[model samples]
Target: MRKRLDFLSLNFLRKIEIRYRLINCFILVSLLPLLISGLLAYGETSSATQEKVRVYSMQVVKQISQNLLLRMEKIEDTSEELALSDRLQNLLTDYYGSDEAASAQARSGISKVLLDSYGSFPYVNQKYILDRKRQVIDPQIFAPLANSVARLAEEAPDLNGRPWWTLYNAGHGQRSLAMLREIRFTGNNRSAGLLFVGVRPSYFFRIFEGIDLGYDSSIFIVDANDGAIVVQNRETGPGNADPALQQGIAASLAQKRDADFIAYTGADKMPYYAAIARVPHTSWLVVSATPSDKLNADTRSVRNKILGIGLLCFAVSLLLSAIIARSITQPLKRLVMVMKETESGNSRIRVEQAGSDEIAVLARKFNEMASKLHQNKEQLEDQVAVRTRELERANRKLEALSATDGLTGVANRRRFDEALATELRRAARSNKPLALLMLDVDYFKKYNDRYGHQAGDECLRIVARVLQKSSRRATDLVARYGGEEFIIVVAESDPGGAIQQAENICDAIFELKIPHADSPFGYITASIGVAALQPDDHTAPERVLRIADQALYHAKYQGRNRVVLGSDTVHTL
Candidate 1:
């Protein structure tokens, strides 16, 4: 038996003996623990640090967005006040009068007022008021930018139609964000002049002042509409931003207006993390960037130290490693089981252990990471839910507005068609009568010519309110059928009832006593036509509409301000 055992041991220990082999295996196994410990510690610390940096960057970007938005809103309010200012309106009104001395005085007074107002706002760099004669109201004060103004006017001759409300970066440091408004007469609402308000680019980009941006980090403002770089701190830092990188980032952000953060590679061939935010009520973006190498510096330091110590321990622990390695092997097996459980969708799983061993520290850190991940997921879901609700509410409001008229605040033609089709179907099902009345204001063209379009709109609104108030049935619908005409559909009403309803609507308009001087009648009145039908499946809905329209013409022909009924024969009331 001794001879057989010696032979077997010799074969097994050809390269090394069993004891030496066990020690070597132990040292190899121990290296894994050290490696894992260093990696886990570095990963936890690095992840935490990066998360903090990202959160801080987001806060900074959001604050900048809000500050810039507030500044813009202030400028916008000033523009509004200037547009409606009576003094400025009077200045423009008397600008072209025949008195040269008064005109000079008015120009002087206007320039002084603009200078005072513009000086009061330290942020505003320029202001201009151009009258209808294409003359600057204050040319002496704004002569420095005369070429730019002329170029702008040449580029857009129709400034009255499409007001410029964005940043303009004409080279030679003449960059400004402008708000253009049209000045109108208070009495006639006629365009008198143009009001131009502008503030330097520094006014918007000043939010970055005193911010503790890390070395080599950059912050910029981007135009969301055209992907243009509005402001940037690239010149102050290392010149690593290439035009391609900027263009790529701007294009990406312009397309993805919803994302708050995005990752990209910079021109320096380094990975970067960017935090982005949009200015409220404006098409602009605020972005900040940090290098990934800086974020991972501590991890690299820790890893290098662990590698040095690990190599030294590999040689030092070779002799006593066999015994020490057994102790950790069992614990590592248990940790592996716990990790497998977590890997199988059991994120709540945790290792049960005590003492300051590496395994114990790893278990605690793992549990912490799991908890944080879960919290972040829940927060993301909550934000998604909030955004979805906002979209749904916005859609509902759009639907309501689309179904109503812009001028009269009543149901529009689209809503009328839908109501008419639905009522026809319901009446056909139940065999009940449906009555439609078409109403037209008498001599509306003459009324519009006499009082102007603004007053004519008011007159239509008053008539609409009266019609809407008179048709107060649950199933009754009043809609603006066409220009200066309205349609009222009364469910379950006969011809007599329909004519009486129409007469009541006409009398209601008369009682309002809106003056229509061109009409033969001294007061505003409506001519209405009534058409009743018991809808059958074969009868077309448009036929009833046509009959009602023809009856309205008959009412107008039989002298306005009367109700006409349509059936086999038309009759006047």
Candidate 2:
């Protein structure tokens, strides 16, 4: 054996093993620093980039909101001027005689006056004058504008004399901001008519263009009242907005608060950092969004540079590791070869400890360690066998305790829940019926009060035994559900079969006839609720329990000591 082993245990193989170990250690030490530095650099860059993006986006949103408010103020001023005009008042006061020709002349004059007033303001899309009766006087100036007149009439119910501005959507994909003011004269202090000025949607669009959101960014106006996109630099298709994001925006608007840095997907399928600010003068939402990728572009560049430096360092370390590994492994090669030879029955070849360092000490210790290890091998085997037998016995005891209820000496809640879950799954898979009966001792608190606590415990144990005996099926399980409540799971049983079983259990408990002199209700009784499992995979384990609980509640309401089945027409019981 010694001669045969000398051929297989060569010196070269030992040197290769030592070289591989040294290389592994070098690689780990070199890469660890590089990994840590790269992670720290990436995290810092990402955090700074996110902060900068948030600050800039907030500034853009604020500036846009201010600009929109200014424009709305200008429109309001124009509306005030139009409402106080003398020409509009005169048109409202002049009521023609019932002659058709005179009425035509007065209508023509009124339309010309309104056209001139509207022409002064380029933002005004249309203008109208209504008489005291809310009838249009300048009908030609607002051609095919029936819908606009009707809406204004509805809005200005108290047309006695008041001015109000409202924003609304005009048909054909146009939104208009309009102001309606009642016209009055000195002698007739009451309102003679209403003056209206409608501003086109372009008025808002032109204001949104001045703000500089980067090339990939966009600014839009949404009508808060109707959730309509009023003016958009880049239009999002219908229903493309995230429902959760929209809900959040709506909630913010409802609360009359501003929403900042909300995440939303844009028309271009890119995620953006969005901020929504409500325009104070109108029910308009000014939204400014910038592509998140653009904001993080600088951080990504910094990360790439850091990774490049780390890779260079790693390459240099790897090269140095190879050189160091070769040097350290040369001496270990001889020691390892001698050890292999000794292990294979070549006892003459002894290792020579050459240095006064840890490695040399380790080489000397290896011989001593090998001899002691051989001596203790038999003892270790015996101890391992003894531990295995002990573990097996412990596992069996644990399994038995797991299945048996600690309180009632019957199946535990965990076992009952598991069995019911398995039966439910099987019933669903095989299209078979599964039923569960939940039973609770009626007036249990009263019983505990009349009798001592000890008697209450004994009563519960007796009830558990009766339930166990009543469910005679091999597949049936009786488990003590928390306190005085107990549950019985019956597999492959229909609603009728479950109900009969529950009734039998209730009767068996009554048959015990334990004397209860302090009981107001003659004898101790129980309420049983039974429910059949529906053959639906989505039906949860708790569904049967809930139904049974509901049935039990109904049984108590009807009268105690009665069994209630879930399938009965009287669902309350």
Candidate 3:
């Protein structure tokens, strides 16, 4: 008897929701503190790591900037030394514009000096001595370099005296930067000629090879005189730095800052940091940046470790809860499956009850509920089908109302525009002729003044009915084109067909014999204009309507109650 009582007690505790609640309580007590502390530590570690990376990136940028400044200064000094040499000055003075052989010997002597001086420098791509016309003396040394110099000189005529950096865009997607300076004689400082120095940006960008600025990180060198990026390793090419970084570099240049950091959003819409530094002895800036996701990659591993341990604890707890709650949960799981089937339109499914326990009682209640729901659903579906049918009929009526004229019961202006566009396309595709007929009630304003508005409305209705009857084919349409103007669009119609239809419409309106005291005809009449054309690839649909309108004006100008062809023929119907 006591064992049976204990069994009942255990069964009472096996309810699924209750069992899971107990397991969750155990987990919260055991792992909550560990998780809280782990997350806090992770945050602190990530912040410190980011700060370190920011400082290190700035330092590396400044170091590279300084090295570049020193190299450029050395290069300038070498150029000055070559410019001041006595041999070059004497060669220029004695042999310039002389005979070919004399000039040859002087050129040979100057070339030797240039070669000797250039050997002292490590990164010179090409060096040349040019005349005032920017012609290289020894074209045989490098013909391409000579041509590039001539083109550069022609493009930048003002680059004489002061040092200048310029870009050369070679065809087939290639470019390079070069330094140019004019060489003058020593004594009177007379302009002897020019010197050309070419260097590839890759030579300077190689300095960043030893450092890693994280994934998707890039470095750029910007020219201060203009907001031009002089060098960048990005695949998009130079002068394409992020706008925020560009703005920050511009600000730094304006403020004359040596080094600084800027924070901005990256292309991914995530926060990013950049380090900016000025290269001394030159108007250049070094900028480096990386997205925050890449910068914080190291901290993510720590987070994954903490999360893995927490998930393992959760899995163990969930396993124990499932074991304890199996009896109650198993039946509930079947009930859930049945409920899903019912939701998917299978209303015949029901749970099987086994014992007189709480689960069994619940199963009985669910079966009864499912039976009632099936009956109610059938009645609801019938009512919904009826409602949907009524709605469809109402919508069709609304569409007809929208497309029909409210006053005259003809096609409205919107329907006319749609039909005209459709017919134009069809005619062009089929290489057929299309026609447009525009009609206007003669002296419509005067008619409205003499007759009442109700009489005017009735007259318009009569005209609409006559126009509708005149449209012989189902594909043709007559539409009220606002006020007393009406349009009739006909497809597959020739010029003769259009003129015949216009004549018919004019005769029918005149036969009505409605009295018009103010009209010149002594009765109501309409002027009809007919325009027709064979639609081709080059034909515009609007041109036909404009022609018809012009013809209508011509008809009115000649006399009322007549049909006018666009070819300027006035026909009395």
Candidate 4:
């Protein structure tokens, strides 16, 4: 029997025995979860980190966008104020006067004013004002253009007296932001002349000088209409942005005028987090492309540590499993049952260690291995919890950011739509009244023309605040609809309540006494159209919007600054 047993053991050892299988299984099972979990942890951490970076980057983009807009508005205001000069306006109004000497003196004075204003600005490259008669007060200022002011006058857009921002060649073949506005007289809104102001590329550098967007970031302003890069950070960063990357950024901005930052690999094999925000009242988008290597550094560090620890543990555990498996043949069945139990999540199940022999040593090894594996499991769970909390935090921030308008600090158009839909659904379920009011600043274009875009923005913000203050209910939503338009959603309000609310808003705006030279009230006023509905399950939000918008049109048609109800006759104030 001893001879037979010895022969069998030798043959079994020569073959691939249970001991070898145990070692292989232990090595594979131990390393596989470590590898998979390390990869998954890396993936999750990277994704979470990227999202946090994106949110942070978007916040930065929003800030720089505000800075750029304020600066651009300052430039525009300077140009408009200079153009609106009573002396300049009078000179251009009587451009064809018989007294050439006086006209020349007036032209010289106007030139002095423009030079004193825009010329003092380090960014101004060209400044000229022209009338419909195709004559420039100062020919030298308009001489650089081969097409002349006539072409500009012809090709320029007429946006109801609002300035048209376009690109211009500021000598030496550098293109820059140019503003062309049909300057008009304060009264009657008559077009007196056109003002053309071209800024140098330094204009971009001036505003973006102190803005830091990490290392090697490219911050640029792009034209939304033509996907033209108006200006980029050339003096400090990369001389020129990659064409494909710029185009991709343009395309992404085109998809949505205001978008959150996103991560993508560039054609150059470099990863970037791109963010975009629209400059108010212009077709320009402020885009920032920041490198993403730093965003992944933390995750890579964690993954490397995990990989090293996992590999070391795998080697040590594999060696111990082979030794334990070979010596514990007598209790292999019981050990296999215990391993199966541990595999099935019974980590506390222990192998009893007894006697001073190899079997006892094997049992101790198994117990130690189980204890270590359980520890790894607990650590992985902690990591998952941390990652989950991080993801939750990011989502909360995103929700807050997405729901507010960047300009007025009110709910944006998207948030407004969502609120309207949600309220409509609630109204449908409860069979309650829901009111939607579309409000517009009376003669806003004229206001912009008179006060410049900066004032217009301030006016909108003031109006938004008033509307926000007027909303007494928690269900009320005030949002900037677009341009100089604002929309309000009042839940559980009747037509009378909604109209009273609109009238209150109008009175509040009127009392503010914000001057408006073009308005009849001589101050900023609102024209509100109220549409109140007892929405059923079948009612559509768009239908309510159309009715309210139509009512708003009628209110403006009935002479502005009044509330008009959708289903009622003209109730003028």
> Highest TM-score: which candidate?
4
- Per residue, candidate 2 scores C-alpha lDDT tens digits across 1-573 of 544333222332333444465566555665666667877998899888777767776777777778777876776666566566676555445553476665676686676666555544546767777776767775433344655675667765563444455665555555576767776664657666677777766676666565676636677766665566666665443222334446657877777686566776755677777778776645667776667798777777888789778766665566444444344454478678877887785555656665554456677887676667666778999999999999999999999898987868988878887988888888899898988888888778668878988999999889988887787788888898767889988888987778777777777787788767655557777888778866679888867776776677567656767778774534322
TM-score for every candidate vs. truth? Answer: 0.43, 0.44, 0.44, 0.46
Model 4 clashing residue pairs (backbone): none
Q: lDDT tens digits, residues 1-573, model 4?
A: 656554443334334445465666555565667778799889988888777767766777687778877777887777777767786777765564688776676676666566556634546767777766655667434244635545766777665867788776554456667788777777667767778887766666666777776646777877766667777766642234456566676667667757656557877788877887777778777778877886577779989898878776665565444444444464566678899999999999998664445455777899999989887998999999999999999999999989999999999989998999999999999888999999999889779879999998999999999999999888899999888999999999998888888999999999999998888889999999999889988888878987787788679767899999997556677
User: Each model's C-alpha lDDT?
Assistant: 0.73, 0.69, 0.76, 0.76
TM-score of 3: 0.44
Model 4 worst lDDT run, 10 consecutive residues = 6-15
TM-score of 4: 0.46
Instruction: List, residue by residue over 1-573, the lDDT tens digit for candidate 3.
Output: 645543433454443345365576466556666678678878987989778878988998898787777766666777777778787887887657567777777876676567666633435656778888878877345466578777886665555466666665543355566767788877887788887776666667666667677757777777765656777755456555566666777776678678988888755678878888987645677888877887777787777787667755664566444444555566678889988998998878989886556667888998898889978987999999999999999999999999989999999989998898888888999999999999999987679879988899999999999999998899999999878989999989998888899988888998999999998888889998888888776666567776787688667756767878886766666
Ranking of predictions according to lDDT: 3, 4, 1, 2
Which of the predicted structures, 1 or 2, would earn the higher lDDT when compared with the native? 1
Model 4, residue 413: distance off in Å is 49
lDDT string for model 1 (1-573, tens) is 645544433332333433565666655664666778788878887888778878888888888888877777777677777677888777766776787887877886676567546744546766777776545677354354655654454454455433456666544545667766667888788888777777767666567778876835678877655656666654332122345445655766668664366677876788888888877655677778888898788668877787768865774565444334444555577788977887776778777654455556776887787667666777989999999999999999999999999999999999999999999999999999999999999888778879999998999899889888988688899899878999999999988888788888887888888887888898888898888988988767678877786677668767889888875345554
